[model samples]
Target: MANPPAVTVCLAGNVGRYKSSLPVGQLLLRGIMAGAYIAVGAALCTVAGTGVAPLLGAGFAKFIGGAVFPVGLIAIVLTGMELFTGDAMLGPLSVLQGKIGWGKVLNNWLWVYIGNLIGSLAYAYIMVWGPFTQGALGAAEPNAFGLNAVAIAVGKTLAYKSVGSIGLWSCFLAAIGCNFLVNVAIMLGITAKEFIGKFFGIWFPIMAFVATGFEHCVANMYFLPTGLWITQLFPSLVDKSTKAADGTVTYWSPLLHKFGGLTWGDVWLWNIIPATLGNIVGGMIFVGFVYYFAFRNEFPEDLMK
Candidate 1:
């Protein structure tokens, strides 16, 4: 059965307290696992969605990608690993409930975010060398999935960079929408008592966020780097060309030329930074604070203990 609202909120606070109290090493280790798990889903999405846009419509392609992207969160929730976006809500909720202080909350965020980065980078490296490339890293061409990864990275960064400050705002807003759904998924996961219930509870909202093309900081941790590494390793792929029947060569990667190849600067400035900030607001304020205040008075005394 599902938990009542008050019970769920209290349970969330309890989970938050346990998370915040973990030592730095535990936080980092769990964070690394969570990051890699998220990358697993992202890799699956990239491979699954590749070339589907032409065969199916763009919408169906998106749905296919989104449909597979929840494996990471499902794994994380069931296994008790830490995710930064989820922590953005859970840690603050613990603070609101007087279960932990803001200092511990921020501490949890800091270590977990760093660990997530490390894990994502590790997975991205694995992808570039493993499935994304045709053979050895230096000599091999990027596979179809790798090429798609490049396109996705470009869309996330250059598409935003093209618009200046407004681009940052757009990324930020999209991130808000992303984590709002993410935490909603987290809440649903908490409310469910059965494994199958937890699975579907987390799946739908996560699928919604990805299909809608919202920004997610941790998932982007995987996506941006995978794209950036592929582009950097295969620089020729940046401005691809095709020979027509009449011997005319056309450049397909217009944005790549306009913005240059994906840079580390572009990754941070355009997507992760703003997305992280927006995720904070979306989770900490939008879901955590809203739900906490709504049920703070209703939490039973035993539940608080």
Candidate 2:
């Protein structure tokens, strides 16, 4: 049997209430695991989608990547690991139920986000030195997987920066869309009473977010940094010369011009920073508050216990 909506909302709060009480160390450790799990999915998405576009067409290739990307979140949820994106909604919802304080919510967010970053970076290094690089341990050109990483990074950062402020807004909006669906996916997982039900519930929304081209900060923590690290190791991968309108040669992208080559500032400003804010709004306001009000008066009596 399926759980009722109110019961699901209450269960989410119960999770939030329980998680809020965990010590910093436990939260961080779970967060680390969650980040790595998410990166596992991100890496698979990048590798699987590598040459698929040429054979299956662009839209289908993206669909393939998106389809595989949900496995990370599935593993995280089933294993009971903490994800910052899900926490963004869960923490606030816990507070709304008067089950936890805002301070605890903030604390949870801070530690989980940091833990996720560390885990993502660690996995990024693994991919950079392992699957992304050549067989002789960085001796040869980056394989197709590495090339896809570079392409994903460039498109997220440089492509957005080229459009100016509008690009930032686009990133921000995309992030909002991402976390909104992410939390909905989380709620669906909670709504399910059976393992198989939870699995499918989580899979579809996550697949939709990635397939639809939404921005997710935690996943980006892996995706962007991995791309940056790989490019640093193989600068030639990004080098390219393009013809200018004046017929003069311009070095950019593959040529290494424009934004002066993917700085930390560009990474955060173009993608991460705005994406984080948008995620907060998406999860906190859209899912947290919306659900809180939806079931506020109808909360189960067991919740009072």
Please identify model 2 stretches exceeding 4 Å from their true place: 135-140, 241-256
Per-candidate RMSD, Å: 1.5, 2.4
**lDDT of residue 125 for candidate 2:** 84
TM per model? 0.97, 0.94
The number of clashing residue pairs in model 1 is: 0
Candidate 2 lands at a TM-score of 0.94
Per-residue alpha-carbon lDDT of candidate 1 for residues 209-266, written as tens digits (9 for 90 to 100): 9999999999999999999988888888766778899999776677887776789999
**On a 0 to 1 TM-score scale, where does candidate 1 land against the true structure?**
0.97
Query: Compared with the true structure, what per-residue lDDT tens digits does model 2 show for residues 90-169?
Result: 98999998898999989999999988888888888899888888554445457778878978988888888898999999
After superposing all C-alphas onto the true structure, candidate 2 shows an RMSD in angstroms of 2.4
Candidate with top lDDT is 1
